[model samples]
Target: MRSLTGFRITAQRSGVAIAGTAAALLLLTSCAGSGEPAQEAGAAVAEDCTPLHEFTTIEPGVLTVAAMNAAPKFHALSDSGPFTGIDATLIPEFAAENCLEVKFKPMTGAAAQLDLREGKSDMFGGLILKTPERAEVFAQTEGSILYETLGITSAKDAAYDTVDSLQGKRVGTLSGSYYVEPLKAAYGANNVEEYQSDANAFEDLKAGRIDAVAWQSIQGFNFTDRDDDYVTKILDDDQKYPELTVLLENNWPHTKGNSAMTAAIDDYYERAKADGTVARVLEENEIGEEAAELYVNGR
Candidate 1:
């Protein structure tokens, strides 16, 4: 008998012609499903025929993953080393399955996309939106690994509730962020102000240069906590933005080669959903309350 990954099979003949014929016959037999019951057919086999673990045989390599330094999601502490949010925990499991290694990089909010575009990073794992325009530059994975709700924040004395309310007021946001589009659509392109980074946007917002700032709920809350003068408020019903997706860079200016990565990402989401790991991560982080519930309930 011959052994491959601990599986012992009769070594009938070790010739190219014999191997080819055996391969064809095995394919044909597999396609022709036996009429016997599955349990009965399995019981008839003398060898222990259970399939080997699917993940162990994949090729091993290092993959660079990028993320913006956002707390409770993806961030680095000078003393604590690099860490991830829900998406981060899944990376090790995925890598173990694929026999790959991961190297994490923290890019500024503005430079994250540029890093991927220049081939400096293999993927970004965070709340990235998949826009048609961006698809030209990168490939997007199927389904959002997490959901983010947008919120508007202002001084406690500021009065605003709806998207129309922000019409003439200056709104601050980070450059190259998904919030830019929604803010532009709601408050006219000119009314939306872009900053180089989230810290800069928060600074401008605190300086009274901008009437309000629009960002993810977690970030909005974090900003408010960091500054005493700022007040965080969830955007009104009319101002809420639709859910967006995270995208990964593909082999662009070449042929489309990120299909495999995209497929793997989709499979990751499916497994995460089935096992409730997604919900657990959200709940542990104390963000995305609604999404966590939906994921936990198997929605």
Candidate 2:
């Protein structure tokens, strides 16, 4: 709900996992007993961080994060007891920079959001789209990545160029997603099939159970990056369906009223963008350049 324009943030990173491996578990436990603030990047001494300590988290010197079980390139709970994907990497870096130990809790759907609202968790780790409805309930950080919804269809079929064009066609989307209702409104409710996961939606599309799949552009690319049978493209925006047409931004969600945490995380992103860390992380995860370059223009 707050704005973070022109903020400055700088923090140090101890050698940690970039590839989402067992090293993340080491990063989490290695600093648990230190109880001291993490040093700034390349600093000779730690800055006075009494203010950071003044703000309360679910636990002292620990940031408990609520994470979804699986979301492909965004986040997944690895068997190694560490999270894998973009948010997984970024969140640990944020914790390390802020001199806090990190703890992850597996949750999904409304329960995940409720965890943040009730102070059961300090933040949500997966990529959360920035929207007014969410902002009204949570203290969302600045735009970290650009998000665009794409329409996926078989290569042999014509693409749905606009939202309304899917009116009579069967379209599948992730259940509980922000686009679900708008998609159902465009493609008649009876024509829309909601799946619990993207894998299920795409499988139904491939088997002709649905005519198309509406999903995140990045995640869709992960599905169709090498397959020639499917193709993905952004659907043109229609005034009647602005939620589907307008470009969206993604950010980390924290409990509302935690202004200090919001400012700290925002500062972290601003510095990460300026130093090329953000783009580097996106690239490592195979996200497109469009998203890597989006932090320059805030929504």
Candidate 3:
């Protein structure tokens, strides 16, 4: 992998059945680039990163992050190789701030968990929600990013208003997405259709093959509001659904009890929020600020 801007990445992408996509592919991880070690959490920007580096890491001076593919905004492979979206892009800066180098190991969420458990990954994030089960295994941070699940249907169709309303309807989302199992438990597995990509799911919804599309709120905004025919329904604050808080917010989860790592990440988040880094990064990535900010910054 080449370092386009002081960061390099490696991805492990599961094959997708998109048009012209390979039926199967395996990825080899790689890394590049070097920089001055960054300062520690809450330390002055110019402070040395030695104290922060004193703590143990999966690889000395190298922060290997585990991430999953959630393209256009999370993870993607380019000519330069694998890299992260807004948050991922911040890794280099995060690394620099902590006096470390950033490398990535891509995998499915399940695989990421395994990697974390076995010590292959020093940390993990990118649309990763903080769940009770995960909380048991990792040092999950409080909301690093916020979102509520949103539902979509063809412009030709009407929005679904309640969980009961979806009882018998056909719903679609990315296969194995966090939304699937819970939706299945509530709507019945038979009624939930999982696809390899959100693009495919939305296509099916548009083709009338599925009744509605369940997605992260920002994703829903991207798929529906962008099109004249499609409309969206945002669940009210009081409602509990697949997109309830626990499942919607992203957390910076690293090794359990690794307060140094936690403080480092949280400090990055706070700076990102204060300096408008998070907001600017979101817009630069073409994500709608209003939709994404609904849950960010306590708005």
Best by lDDT: 2
> lDDT by residue for model 2 over 262-291, one digit each (tens)?
887777777766676666666666555554
Residue-level lDDT tens digits of model 1 in 1-299 = 11011111111111111000000000001111111111211112223333212222112254455555555445443212334454445554454344344455555555667767777666654456555666687777656565444556788677355556677899987677767886787678998898755566777777888998876545555556445566665443331434311212211111125667767666765676667666666665554454344324422
Q: For every model in order, what is the number of clashing pairs?
A: 1, 0, 6
lDDT of each: 0.50, 0.59, 0.56
Question: Which runs of model 1 end up more than 4 angstroms from their true locations?
Answer: 1-60, 78-80, 225-229, 236-256, 288-291, 294-299
Residue-wise lDDT of candidate 3 within 1-299, one digit each (tens)? Answer: 11011111112332232221111111212221122222223332233344332356876766777665454345545322345465566565666545565566654555566678777777774566666777787887664744444444444356665556666889887654567777887788899888766567777887889988876555455555456577666554434563432325566568998877777777666666677666665665565545545546543
Q: What's model 2's overall lDDT?
A: 0.59
Better of 1 and 2 by TM-score: 2
Candidate 3 pairs with clashing backbones? 37-99, 38-96, 38-97, 38-99, 39-97, 155-229
Highest-TM-score candidate = 2
Q: Lowest-scoring 10 consecutive residues by lDDT in candidate 1?
A: 18-27
